[model samples]
Target chain A: MMRRIQSKALLASFSLAAVAGSVIAAAIIYAPEIKPVERPLPTSFDPGEVAKGAQLASIGDCIVCHTADGGRPFAGARALPTPFGTLYSDNITPDEKTGIGNWSFAAFRRAMVNGVARDGSHLYPALPYEHFTHVDDADLRAIYAFLMTRQPVEQVQPKNDLLPGLGFRPLLAGWKLLFLHEGPSTRDPARSAEWNRGKYLVEGLGHCGGCHTPRNILGGEERSSDLSGGIAEGWIAPALDKSNPSADRWDEASLFDYLTTGIAGGHSAAGGPMGPVAEGLSTVNDADVQAIAVYIASRMKPESALQKAASTVATLPRDVASQDPASSKSTIAHPATDTLFAGACGGCHMPGAPMQVTGRPPLSAVSDLRMTNPRNAIQAVLQGVAPPSGRGPAMPGFADILTDQQIADLLGYARAHFTDASPWPDLTAEVSAIRKEDAR
Target chain B: MTVSLIVNGQRRTVSATPDTPLLYVLRDDLELNAAKYGCGLGQCGACTVHLDGKAVFSCLTPIGATQERQVTTLEGLGTQAQPGILQQAFIDEQAAQCGYCIAGMIMRAQSLLDRNPAPSDAEIRRHMQPNLCRCGTHHRIIRAIKRASAVLGSQNGKGDAS
Candidate 1:
């Protein structure tokens, strides 16, 4: 009986030891290192340093993400939609209660470099700390100085509505271990100073890859498809690499022009999310813009002839069909489309028409015609482009002006007459849906 | 603070902060309406002008940075009565749409022509790429530049032959 009792006691102790071991393992896996941050008493900074900080902020494009439309700058509350869910941006203003006004330099550094909150909770990589981790100490200090100098705004940001699985902060500790590469990057010795500067801005602070690079199932950027292309804010961020779809090669000059001016002559226009990025980049130094162009050009190899042909649609000038000797034979094949185009669009779109020479983008070379998807084209037709601010001659929306059947017919004609592209899928349903949604 | 500038062949002085963009000084102080303010940042070449004969965004260039440099705007190119060769070519080709981006386009084109008196169609397109024409006058713009290049070429040839 005594021996039996001893055996039971031993079993009990063994079970206790197992439970304790499991607890310890769980703690190690979940808990991040929580260090106390020390901050000096607040003091005014040098004006020059503060000015430099402001410039750096512009380069980083802090205002675009932080400020919601029609909201105070840097007061935050911008809803960033993601595949996961909508996450709200935080107020970075110097409000002690609502913003980062009370955050010490050490606390700010920890958050920027380590992606940790003041309470030692893991921050979502959505903040882009993965890239900002490479930001040098001097820039970080300057940013901190700039934020500290700003007027303290009293506003609280809405909580992030992350997808259910992402709500658990401890899971992010494992994510950090898997993905985050903390510290400054090692520069390649073979590269020029300009190339390195471009790399720094594009990879480190600009975080172009964050949006441009495709992501995996877990939301980390897919390493194999770097800058090949990705989707952001419901628009496709086209491949910046050799896979860029422009018929002509993007030389350094063209790339520089595109970045600096938001347009590359006949190539493409900056719209959607990229529009703001282009505007922000315009504030940076000319040399830096050049450097970025140099870096991007270096990545893109000259495309193959087959690839170029596949990419470029034969956007013949308007006079081509009307004047071409071979057009009579081709016109016989699709007389209905020809008639539809002439009636619907020929008024202003034909060669030498006043609107064609004046306000209208040539039907032949417009970026929308070349896109693989018909979304931009359909949207432009249904809801006409408002000429940019102070750049007047706004095109009227065709939602009320044209019937769905007529739009589809016109689109079909545009594809046949203006471009060599395979006709985009019938867009009648899409036009109808968009019009209904707009009405609502 | 007062900043002295050489604007469109005229020496002018304006009171503004040293860091103020030259585009603003030209617009607000000198009242030169040709150089537009499309994007306060230089993303739109509407604010492009020649600084020391090189095309630069006036919106991005600070007033302090332009000391002792010649700044040329579209107004300097020529007025409505007597347009320069490039300006006249643009008019002949109807190369402008809204005309907001025209000043910068002309300036960029001038810089290209100055460097390369006879640029190929491809070279002209590449050089002129920096100036955006949102209305898509690019094809016509190319033609105008080529037309101007031919005219300039003939003029040069005649001078040399004589």
Candidate 2:
């Protein structure tokens, strides 16, 4: 009886040890590792610091993503759409109750560099802290100072409308463990200061890769295809790196001019999401813009002789309007489309026309249909160049004037006539979608 | 709150919330009717005005933000007897279709020309893209800008005839 009781007690103790051991292991794996948030706070900063911060923020393009459709700037309520769900941006204003007014400098740093929030919760990658992780201490401080000085808007961020199983914030911990790369970007010793600066800006604060580079199923930037181009904000941000199709049109001079002034010597004009980016870049110093241009140019392979000759031909003024409709009708495979283009586009796009005197760039020079996505071209046609910039001919939109079918036909005809590139396969569907939205 | 601003070379004080859009203050309080409310959001160019010589969307800009800055609306640009060069050019080009977005377009164009008196067609298109005009008068608008540039250029003793 004594032996039996001793064996039973031994078994009980063994089970207790196993349970405790499991608990300890789970704590190590599941619990957030708390670090001392020791960074100092600033009560006030000088004008120079504030100015530097503002410049960094501009490079980040913070305002475009943070501001909602009608909400105040930086009072984040912007519903950023993702494949998983719509994530509402958090307000970064200095409001004590609802914003980051109470967050310590260390907390802000951790959030910026580590993708962790003030409460030790993992932040969604939607904030682009993955790229921000590369920001150095001084520049980050400057940005923080600039943000803190802004008017404290008393706005609470709305709840994220994320799809089920996606909003489980705890899951972000595992995601971070798998993919979050933390640390400042080290410069290559072989590169020049200008090249390094460009790389730092383009890769870090500029976060150019966030939109310009393609994303994987997990929504992270596909590193292997960096700057090869990606679709962003519903428009195809054309490739800036080696895969660039129209490399001949974008020399260093033109890129610098485009970045500084939002126009590339009549070769193209900034439109869609790039419009806002150009506006922001317009305010930056000339050297920085030039650096960006130099870096982007370096990424591309030199244009071949054939490409140069083809581009020259493409840019030449073509009289698509003057051709006799009766004679040219047989040459056009899509007669209806040809007719639509002639009636709607020929008046101003043709040479010597009244509107052409306004310095209308030839339609042949326009690379509107070259993008993998048809959104820009479709929107341009639907909206017309309603906002006429000085860069190119602002064609009036035919949304109110033409049917979706007619517009599709017109676009198809223009694409067929204009470039050597393949036409958008779903042209009709794209036009219909634009029409359904009423070109808002 | 009371905000003081230098509008079109005039000093004015107005009562409004701190975050109230500058466009409302200019239109409602200052009685400057030239800048129209197109989108009320920054997306439309209808409420463009020169904020310290830079063309910015007034509808998106808060009144408090413009306290020490110069705000130039269309009313300040010129009058019937002595219209501003850009405004006169717009008239000559007949750039106004419905005329709703013309004020904003001209203000934006004025800012552009102030910076670059003789901008290329591409430069103009890129700079003036932020302002939207619903009417298909973009060609005429561009023409008016060029004409304004020429007039200003000749006045400055440098003109691009090409």
* Residue B94, candidate 2: alpha-carbon lDDT: 99
**Cα RMSDs of all predictions?**
21.1, 17.2
lDDT of 1 at A80: 86
CA-based DockQ, model 2: 0.02
For residue A316, give model 2's deviation from the true position in Å.
6.6
Worst 10 residues of 2 chain A by lDDT: A385-394
The residue pairs in collision within model 1 are: none
For candidate 2, the docking band is incorrect
Off by over 4 Å in 1: A1-43, A302-363, A376-412, A415-418, A425-440, B1-162
Strongest candidate by lDDT: 2
Give the poorly placed runs of model 2, Cα more than 4 Å off: A1-43, A302-331, A334-339, A352-361, A372-375, A383-400, A422-426, A433-440, B1-162
Chain B TM-score of candidate 1 stands at: 0.93
For residues A1-440, could you state the per-residue lDDT of candidate 1 as single tens digits?
Answer: 99999999999999999899778646644434445433223466777777767766866778888887667889889888777888788888878777777787777887888888766777778788878898888888988888778877788878889878887887877777777888796687888999888888777777788888988887888757878878766456777787765434465676786777666553545555676777777777789888888777767655344345334424333433344423743355455445445433554456665555553445665656666766656666665544432243434344533467667766766766666667677578866766675564
Model 2 CA lDDT for position A439? 37
